[model samples]
Structure formats: C-alpha cells, structure tokens
Target: MLGIALLAHWLLGPPVVDFSHHSALSPIDMVATAHAEVKKPLTVNWQTLRELDYTTGKATPTVLNLLGTDTAVRVPGFMVPLDDSADAVTEFLLIPYAIACVHVPPPPPNQMIHVKMAGEKRQKVAWDPVWVQGRLQIVEMASPYGEAAYILTAVLVEPYTD
Candidate 1:
C-alpha cells in the first residue's frame, strides 16, 4: 500500500519547478515584451549613447529610461574582475567586449554591468566567455575607471559556448 501511494504521488504530484532562480528568458525576448518601459534586459547601443561629461565622467540620465529595472535576465559577456584576480572572482564587471575595461577605456554606462555574484562560490574568471543570469537593477555605479548603468545580483553562472 505504501509503495502504491508513493508511485501515485510521483506520477500525479505537481511538477517540480526550481523557484530559486530566474527563468530561462532570452534577453532579446525579454526586451520585446517590455515595449520600451523598464521591464527586461536591454541591449546597449554605443552609437546612440549620450556622451558623458568628460570631467565628471557622469552619465546622461536619459539612458536610464531604457533600463531593465528590477527584471530577471540573462546576458552573455566577458568577465572583468573587480576583485583583482584573473582566475577567480566573486564581484566583477561584465562587459560587452573582453578587452573592454582592461585594455581600452571602458565604454559608456549602458555598455557595462556591475555584477555582485551570490554566495561564496567564487566564479573562475575566464577569457572564454560566460552567461550571467540574475535580476537586473537599473542603477548607476561609479568606479575609478568607468561607470555602469546597471547592476545584477547574479544567481546563476554558466560558461558561454557561442
């Protein structure tokens, strides 16, 4: 009788869904659904970037309108560790280009994301590439080198293949 009950529960129980992390929503689709109001991951366009003040390096707040706000998203980028290590990182900057913050002048605010990874599972920094999944917040952050228009509290990390 116990065995039969267990089998029935296994077959009829609600599907186990992991609620601990963001769903697998593509960045592009997320933006499409947002319809320009702050709702999802938005692609940074350097071409239309509002030039920052050179002295203050202050970002024009107008771009903040395009921000994804407090929305879940996944983005693929190269890690630029702020923890000061190339092999491991807990806090880092994710940029559209691998050499973005390291070699050249960091791009404008919208072009980068300040990522504070969750927990002590320090992610191994790699030049290969990675996909960061988490809730994105539209906020301006200042660093010595550059500014980021958004910050993400990463919940999932995965190696990028393409």
Candidate 2:
C-alpha cells in the first residue's frame, strides 16, 4: 500500500496548493520579495525549491536572489531526525515526502532542507507532516543521511493542516 501511494504521488506530482489563500507569491514573486526585503513570511513549496541546480554548486538567479535576505518562509514536509533523542529534536532534514531518505534513496539536495530549530528551541520529532517556518538560507549542509542545498533556521514548528 505504501509503494502504491508513493507511485501515485510520483505520477501525480505534489498536491495542488491554493496560493491565492496564502501570500499568492509564486517563485518569481518570491525573488522579487526577497530583493525588496519583505519581512512577512511567504509560503514556499518544494516545487519552487526543486528549481535549484545543485550539480554545479551554484544557485540559479532566482535562488541566488534569496541568499542573505531576511525572507521568512513556511515550508511543510516530513522530518528525518538527525539527533539520537527519542523525544526532543533540534536538527533534522525536511523532505517533501514521507520515507524519502529512509526506505528509498534520498531526494536531490535541492529537494531536502536542513532544518535547525532557532536558538535553544526544541520540538518533539513529528512522525506526521509538519510546517517549518523560518528564514530560508541557501547553504550547503551535509548530514549522515544526505546533503541539503538549503538550510532553514526555524522559528516555529507546527503540525501540518489543510
């Protein structure tokens, strides 16, 4: 059943998101907002992040525009814990799909985000999906599980809702 679900998700692509209800900021708009130094958190999807080219270790113009900017963003994904703790989790990789880095091969670097809880903040590892809100930085991070092209210093971690 899990295999079938994975196959279906792969074939169908990411679930449809109503951007109109959110910031209505598309990938292009995200770059513009980044340049404008917008402080409001924008909703970012994995599809937009997947546009990054990790092979050359260089970010595209759009992704590059986001670097060093105070562009707060909210991204929803499953947590792949990096710490050994059974309860609290301070660092983890956030992947678009569940079982991405485990049961199957890890996704591309751009598809995974290295999430670090802000300051001394810590949250319990969530088996279900969660939304990580933070300032997104284009930094290369390596973990025992996989490499990530982006690092998010998360300020808030909450369960994902429709």
Candidate 3:
C-alpha cells in the first residue's frame, strides 16, 4: 500500500493525498537540530539585498546597514500554489506576511527555504506546517519567473503547526 501510494504520488502529483490528520514537529525542535548542524555563522549584508520591482521589471541592488553577524534566519511560511496542478509544487518560497506573495514578491535569497524531506512523511505534501531548515545563501539564481533572486537552500523541511 505504501509503495502504491508513493508511486501514485510521483505520477499523479502530491495534492491527491490528504494531510489534515498529519502530525508536524514544532519549530523549536527543528531549530535545535539545525543548531547542531550549524558549524559556522552565515551572514548577509543588508545593504547588498537586492530589491526587485515586478511592475516595471526593474532591479535595484543596495547595501544594507544593519547590525548582526547571522545574515540568515529561518521562519515559518505557508505554501501557496505555484503551479495549476493540485499535486505539483513548482517551487517553495518563504513569505514574510500571511498574504506575502499577493502583497510582496518574496524576501531576499537569504530567507528562502530549499527543503529536503527526511523520511516517509517528508515525501508527502504535508498540509501541516513543516520546518524549512537551510542556510541563507543570498545569491542570484535563475528563477522560473525570470531574473535570479535571493533564496535559501532548505536542508530539511520539518513539520509544524499551521
């Protein structure tokens, strides 16, 4: 049954499964694990954060004057539909606001979450909150939407409260 389900998920996509009953790990627990993984500090120059304007399609790169050694932070974000298919998740971008994509494009690349699932539950499209564990690599990369943007490479996407 598990194999069949996984095969179906791969072929048909993720949304076919229901996760309302799924259990997720807490943010604190995930952080503890991430702390153990962290060997050195990663910093992002606030002034270097690039601001993109979709309306005009203009990009402005400036230096940020802020006080902090840790240039990256992992925060909880809701998953929004990136593709038309119910099962397909084209990309996972972190939003600062409850209605982030609608109001804003996205945070700097340092804030992006590139999640890597751990186990079986991780493979499934979890409606439950999952921790986006990764480092904040504020660099430019080609985006499906066009123009490389700031993003984080999520190491482990854990479960969390919605």
Best by lDDT: 2
lDDT of 2 by residue, 43-69 (tens): 788888887888877666666545555
TM-score top scorer: 2
lDDT of 3 by residue, 80-138 (tens): 43345456343555433345445445554443333322332223344544555445543
What lDDT is reached at residue 102 by model 1?
68
Candidate 1 residue pairs in clash (backbone atoms < 3 Å): none
Model 1 per-residue lDDT tens digits across residues 48-162: 3344443454556644433343555677888878887778788888887777886556787767788898876688887767888776666688876588877888877788765
Worst 10 residues of 1 by lDDT: 2-11
Give per-residue lDDT, candidate 1, residue 8.
Answer: 39
Off by over 4 Å in 2: 1-38
lDDT against the true structure, per candidate, is: 0.65, 0.79, 0.42
